[model samples]
Target: MAKQAKAKLDRKGLGSLGLEKLIDILLDEAAANKALKARLQTALAGEMGPDEMARLIDKRLDAIDQSTARINKARARDMAVEFSALARNILSELGAVDPQAGAERILRFLGLRFPISARLVADSARLWKVFDDTETAAQELIQSVDAEEQVLLVPHLERLRLRDRYGEHTGFLLGLTSVLAAPGAHAWRDALMAVLADEPMKFGALDLAQRLSLRLADIDAFLSLEKRKPENRRDTLTVAALLAEAGRFDQALEWVRERPRGMRLIPVNGSLTSVGPEYGAHERRMLEAEILERLKRREDAQELRWREFSETLNPEVLKLYLSKLDDFAEFEEMDRAFAIAAEHEDIYLALDFFISWPRLDLAARLVERHNHDWEGRYYDDLAPAAEALSAKEPRAAVLLYRALVEDILRRGIGMAYPQAGRYVGELARLMPELPDGHGLSTHAAFLAELRRNHSKKYGFWSSVPGGMQG
Candidate 1:
């Protein structure tokens, strides 16, 4: 006898159980579950009209706002579910019947964000996510409301912004830029500008004003706000990129040409090190090239692209350079690019380029040529390159695997022993396929060397299958 398949719990399956049965199940579940009961009551109120629905949702919001209890993890999760359900009712039930009322209630719900966040004993990602999602939905609802209504809601939004003590609702107001009518936008701009006027270095106000200006397509306002800050290479590049995007090529060019100042320090081995004023030189040059292209300086653009490619061995830049060449010139340029990549100072970068370019044959040859330079510390690049070369170039793969194994044992990185053990297994499998004069030791010889040098690395040998006999 064959086993029977279980019925799925989908709408179709449930419908077959009859509406009376479904109602009985809901009654049983709702009696025990307070959240479900509230949701059912909200749904029942929706049938009365948008007014009744809004009243119920407003009552819940008021109760939530008035409560000052510190919510622990479990209650936080439950509260998140409740808040999400309220937001859904506001958007679906109230929004469908009366968008204006729905939008107002959404704003009221959003106003509870700071208070709710403050009352939490510990951080609640679940509650925060609910708020983020509700904000997004509120934006959509507000956009759907009448323009005059949007103008009226600006004050409410401003109130919300003013009450945001923790900067939790960072983009809430700025995200409404598209939905705001001209009057509403002007009102919002004025309010943010007032904040900036009183506190010039206020990051939140200045950021909002600048972003709103861009949304209004007012580039001058954006730049004027930018000028308030001290100029640096990073900001200069940003202004230039924005100018280029706005099709003001000449001004963009001037911004890009501004002499970069100040040393940009970056983390290296858990310490800050100065990378000089040329920190983002590559991006600056690329942006300059783009501006030159827009200005019809094809030769200059190609020249800049080639320089970037030569210095970085970037495949994308090389492709862009090749794309601009006349027909049939791409093939010749590609060969030139490959030769440049083979001799690039960073062997790992060159390998990355070839692997990304899918020129595995050249990647294998490049690996063999720079065999001694393959560092296991750079397994990030070498491991993937080996995997790519395994089928067609097992010998090269063996070399990379050997480097990885040696580096792990040499450094005594116990955490990486299992990974090294896997590599050892691969080397053993690839040994038979290796031709003579590969300039690499046989698999047995390599294992014996590992044992001689790192005999106490039991963690590594144990992880290897067959106790390293492979």
Candidate 2:
């Protein structure tokens, strides 16, 4: 028996992205003479030894080889026919022969056709990259391109003025478009790429490129004024605005610098960090709105909007907006902040603001919204949990007294946590193994009191005995 021929597909050659199509056509041609081929192979194999069978396979491969060239020519003709038809269609979607539009169309053509194994189209993009290399490279580059690729781009570039980002920065249209068309920092990266094209030159290319490529860490380092003081930063930031069009700080960072220092490096690793020129809530909303609109991601845009009913004059206006808006999964940040605002005891408001709330609940949720100080909120929440322990509710007075002992730590007093001496004795007499001890970082004096009262049972003088983390 003769074995089937085996050969790997060749990826190289003109416009071979369509190789599978050509292969299909070759197989179809072979199959058309099915009866003749079967008889011929049977006779040939009968007379031929195994070594000779290999020669027959080689001959068959040679015969198939001629078919590939023919397929390529046919495909080229088909593409040109399609391109002409597509050219007429372009008049409808694209404006005119203006340089930008022509350049844009060239890019669009390259992008649309490359993945189909269209070797010609891939080469075309490469040609454009080369043309971008020098002043007169475009025409020479066109000459080298296959006749098919030249048909469309040659006519288009006659009037384009792309002196800014051509040459070594030649791939802006492809790379920038590719990056921006992707999900996140690609847009920002594309904006920064203009400097490579000599357009308002500023920061070092490799540095900016490397930094933006660091995934979500873009938010970690705020654009420091220090970077701006040395020149290029202002122009660079401007370019960033024009390229992205979203997150227009409008010199907002200037205002931020006037204030004292500290909270600079963007919200850790979150996207919208403010090094000074941070965007206000309204501005951030508008910018995000425009981008989503352009991307045709309207549903996502709408989802980012906060509620429309918040009072404009509220002290925590941003907080109110946050509660109304719903972009982030953590919907309760503003809710928690506002809830914390609505309570108190012997503590001052200014001081409560200082207590490092990095404190959270079971789900790492902020504890403020859990209604720590408000009797109404706590009674409402704890009511069910309290009822669950109804056997203890039977001992309500004693438990209520124990609850007061717990409050010594639960209160959101700033650095000031003066644990009243009254509830300590009963708490130690009851629940001994609470998660955190009585010696919390809440305050110095209060911690001292907790240690004295519950030293034998509570161990250390703590405050937040049951808070969770987010």
lDDT by residue (301-418, candidate 2, tens digit) is 4444432112121334344335435588444755554454434222223112322221112111212233243242233333333333323322322243334445534453323232
Residue ranges of candidate 2 with Cα displaced over 4 Å: 1-470
lDDT of 1 at 90: 83
C-alpha lDDT of candidate 1 relative to the true structure: 0.83
282-314 in candidate 1: lDDT tens per residue? Answer: 889999999999999999999999999998988
lDDT of 2 at 466: 32
Highest-TM-score candidate: 1
Query: Cα lDDT for residue 251, model 2?
Result: 40
